[model samples]
Target: MSRMRYFTKVEFYNYRADSGGEKAGYYALIFFFYNALIIYLFGLLMYKTDFLERARLYYSNEHLFKLAIYSPIFILELAPLLFLLRSKKENLQSIGLTTSNTAISILLGIVGAIPFTYQIILDFILHKKEIQLEGANLWVEFLILFIFTALPEELMFRGYIQTRITGLIKNKYLAIVVVGLLFALMHIPFQMSMVNMTFMDYLITNWVYMIQLMVMHIYFVYLYTRNNNILVPIISHTLIDYIQLYIK
Candidate 1:
């Protein structure tokens, strides 16, 4: 395969026998809206309501709370794709789940992650920040970050959304940017809750960060389209989150 390019044409797997650009675009919009709604409602329940406090009364284990939030979202994100696959008799590879380009994909992922990795190292040296795992369960944290956060996200955004958009838009760069914007927008509610910011405040104060997120996702789009392998972006996404969570 040739080296990946920003303007390179993106190839997509045919999830449906009669998959046309218009049809794919329609389903993609539906999936995006569904995901955004789920996230918005969950964020409201977690932060705006007394749901977490009420739940904490019964479940003493703090990990359960994280699991409670992530597990359901993960399942919800994967459900539509799973249902389509089962009904269509399509295999996992239909969403770029195969290990066909495992070695190259991993290499590219690591290569793409180096700059952020260097920044973490620099922070450690300059600020003397201590690297520590957030919880006692190291493997559990890794699994949760990798399986729940990274895998489903890459599968949804890069695998499904980007693929469909690439088909709909002739300009691959435009398609990737559109997916990047959607990816960034999806995080707005959750980020607002984390920072205790109102929607307007978030847009005003964190617009730069939002654009950076979009750029970061654009790279993820490049990674996925580069090798036509979801693992490329999945590995990079997991590694970046792991380092930020554990190291920084």
Candidate 2:
């Protein structure tokens, strides 16, 4: 038996295939169907799981803030939904139904970092807000958050549901608007759980944030068009998140 290599080209290719189990539009429908199933199953399970308890060992006002702040932004929830999008790899290379590029990923990451840092600094200078230094294990939580959460969520929503449904409509901007709205609604559970917000609150609060979120989604679309690389968006998203966390 041969020892497994830490990082190999062949292994990377294999993992990429596994990232997208089927063709873009193929899993998109599955994600749409399975998504509801996943919600029912997971929702039922979470309701019974330790996570169901409102008053737990970790419960607090701070935890409320944690929930409200992190839930929609989690991004990983989209993973299960990736089954719903289009693949761009064929436009790039052999069997290249899709490809994940790293260089542009790094560029967007670096770009997103500077502005985030600047915002943090501005907050500090004006003494209007402050970022608490909460102790966290970067590599560990990041793995749990991004790998287990964000990437999958992005794959499912932006990738799966959008592409599949949009294919029928044939209107690009409308497709994004439709999917983005659904993406926002998908977080309703968290919205309901984390805070006592009304319909107006949900719409109003998100309207401001949605602008940035939509822009990020567009950037991912651009990356998809250029390199057929979902990874670029994934990595860009992950790094941008970490940078945001650090800056705050």
Q: Considering every candidate listed, which one attains the maximal TM-score?
A: 1
Question: lDDT, candidate 1, residue 135?
Answer: 52
Best candidate, lDDT-wise?
Answer: 1
Candidate 2, residues 1-248: lDDT per residue as tens digits? 12212213232222232333234345455555555555544544455456556434455554454554346434334533321222342221221224344666556544544543566667767875644437655565555456645566556554445544543444667766666666655555445334556656766877766666666666655544444445555665666676566545
Worst 10 residues of 2 by lDDT: 1-10
What count of clashes does model 2 give? 26
Q: Give the whole-model CA lDDT for all candidates, comma-separated.
A: 0.76, 0.49
Q: How well does candidate 2 score on lDDT at residue 101?
A: 48
- The TM-score that candidate 2 achieves is 0.57
